[model samples]
Target: MTQKRISKELQECLTTPPAGIKVNLVDEGNIHNWNIVMDGPADSPYVGGKFQLLLVLPTEYPFKPPKINFKTRIYHPNVTFDEHGSMCIGILKSDSWKPSSRIPNVLTAIQQLLLEPVPDDAVEQGAAQKFKEDRKAFDKEARDMTKKYAK
Candidate 1:
């Protein structure tokens, strides 16, 4: 049941992909893992950067939320600035996730996170504090990180 649902969502995302985002299964026979590439949105520090991500669906997907992690480094309040780049997206949380949610919506929510980081619910406390207290410095650091890692 999980495989069938994942396949359906994968096909839907492929057929009607979100702008600046592309995704593909890691293996043709396996529907549990996906590779994603996202272009950073403009008017933000990450503009001009292309970020890679991994989306792993558990065997009980639809019943459990998918795990998304940045394969590439990024500097944002909601995304940890490290190799793991674990993100803090509200929609992906077990508390907020719904079985009705689809891959496209998840990707869209990620994009929105890039455009607007939620400092109040940050994964990286320092980054969140900087983002909330010093917008200019935060943008500069994020842009620098983008150039170093995402470019």
Candidate 2:
């Protein structure tokens, strides 16, 4: 039942994706896992980059939030450093996630996160510091990393 709901949502997202983002199942048989690629929003530091994330649904999904982790290494304050690429978004976390939220909402939130990072709660301290102290350098590093990974 959970898988069916997720599959239906995936189909809806694929057919009518939010602006500059795409979502699909990681494998045909795995409705519990999804692969998402987001195009950076215009005028943001992440512009021109394609970011990837893995979304894993728990057995009791919708009631429980899905797990989201970045598959592409990015130079972002919200993404973790250890190459694990974990995101520091509120909605993805258990505390803030809502059962009513859909896949499109999650992907949109991620894209918005790229455009405007939540520096107060940062996963990558260095990147967060850079973002706050040196805007140009931060942008450069983010752009460079995007070029390398977001293919």
TM-score of each: 0.95, 0.93
Index of the highest-lDDT prediction: 1
lDDT tens per residue, model 2, 59-135: 89988999988888888898885567898787877888888899888888888888898888998999999999999
Q: Which residue pairs show collisions in model 1?
A: none
Please write out the lDDT profile of model 1 over residues 19-137, one tens digit for every residue. 99999988878888999999999988999999999999999899899999999998888888788999988899899999999889999999999999999989899999999999999
Q: Residue 123 CA error for candidate 2 (Å)? A: 0.8
How much is the lDDT of residue 61 in candidate 1? 95
Which one wins on TM-score? 1
What is the lDDT of every predicted structure here? 0.92, 0.85
